[model samples]
Target: MESGKYIIVTGGAGFIGSHTVVSLLESGYSPIIIDDFRNSKKFILDRLEEITGKSIVSFDFDCSNQEKLREVFSTYEVHGIIHFAADKAVGESVLKPLKYYENNLQSLVSMLKISEEFSVTKFVFSSSCTVYGEPDQVPVDENAPIKYTASPYGYTKQVCERICADTAYASDHLRITLLRYFNPIGAHPSGLIGELPLGVPNNLVPFVTQTAIGIRQELTVFGDDYPTTDGTCIRDYIHVCDLADAHVRALESNSDEEVSIYNVGTGVGSTVLEVVNTFEEVNGVKVKHKIGPRREGDAAQVYADNKKITEALHWKAKYTLSDALKHAWNWQKNLDESR
Candidate 1:
């Protein structure tokens, strides 16, 4: 294991997971990735090696398989774990609720069970702002009560947070940090490995980039009749790298509480129109787009208070919307050339 603190990053090949892996390595930790390539590709490991100039260590298997995960625990003296292995498409989760429940819930349960068995203490969960569920107000803080989830995917995250809390409450060895991420957009600054969704893109930035790159013909604005400044839904879009840094910070911070929760976001809300416009302005590429009906599970407007995470973990988003869009476009261009 190269003689460093080993952290297990489940779903480490996915978009946010891959970026966090980079952050973990840069922060002097050895990240052991456990992924099944169900939603990601094996070539991401090569990309990681290329970006870090270090050999990447990873295993291919579903994390819900307790026996397979146990073998991994037996091989390495695991110090901590960051669980990100789950079906995360909100729209798909709505269409296939059973799939979301079975995969998202079971994988977490398995990870928690293995943690207790192996006595690995620290855990960082990849949570979402969807847990907030159409908050009554903007700039929602960590204390905000989780309201009605707009989709089954959001419900899975909400339930997973509860599962982590209850597990930690019952165990003496675990310290868990739940990071409620707002909209996570953009790619790594390296432009080597970024969001590479299979089939069709789910998130807005990817769809925008794909459209800009001609992989997709036009982007669809989900809703534009909402009561916002631009008559569209709003979100606090944080860069993937900024979000990744928060995971390292959470791992490094010391706290007595069994479970800690923080909101990771840029403390400002931007409308869908604003994001599209900003991308066009920054990349100098016209994204062919048109308005459409509201998506089944979408919150109208949600941002972050971010004071607690700032004061406690000393982490705040440092990337602007323009920077994120530019990086995302650059990543798309890189992907196009590689193809």
Candidate 2:
């Protein structure tokens, strides 16, 4: 048990960050949450306590504020950090590039500076597979050449990874691991927490779930002319729990390399149509959807070649696509009932 080893999770109240906090508690590590509630609700902190039976230690502030963040370091003997605070919306990024750049990059740089000052050694960065942009091939690996990103969101992730790598190179103590995630869907099976997007959802699963539950009138399949199995875009939709568990593994795993990179995903691609069909079949609900024009900054087909993370951190996605959709529907239903 890492009894008193306090790991700070920025954006800890958000969807993936909340789940990772649960994972951290289950693994016997004390996690302190830092969030601004810019894109998340405050009630999630209570849910975390409800799930874990532990009073969470948290601070409510944007991590980009260096002085406020420094206070956390001064108070607690911080052991490590898992940075997940960023404005993550591909389509929105195309519309508001400045918002993405300012919030995403500034938060990352602020966190990095705090880590350096506090001498927090182990760092896990929440990265995205969108860094690959429109890959030259399907099932892109960690070794794939990072081409020009399609959106400002992806550009921020790419730049953040570089910043972490360069920081690791300069520092003797900081060891950073960049986990490039593919699409993450599903909710906690307990239905206690899930992806709760504030406005219109930028991701497919939440929008699909909302459509099923009647919050959204219908779903829109972004593009049907892409060069893929069903002409719709394909993604590697791993369960959010599986993705959250990978963070714990990445934090626990040891390596001689200062900056390590891994692709955290199921090594398979499911088309947009497949996801919709599977959701209907598994949960006994139909999602009314139409073929809309292609969304900007979308890749034709992007999945993971996840052999490296499997071997290095002993991490592999456990939940199936059908299971993910089923859980997603259950979460949506749960939210509806609560309201």
Among these predictions, the greatest lDDT belongs to 1
Kindly report which residue stretches of model 1 are placed more than 4 angstroms away from their true locations once superposed: 1-3
Q: What do the candidate models score in CA lDDT, each in turn?
A: 0.92, 0.91
Instruction: Show the lowest summed lDDT stretch of 10 residues, model 2.
Output: 1-10
lDDT of 1 by residue, 264-313 (tens): 99899999999999999999999999999998767788999999999999
Query: Candidate 2 regions off by >4 Å?
Result: 1-3
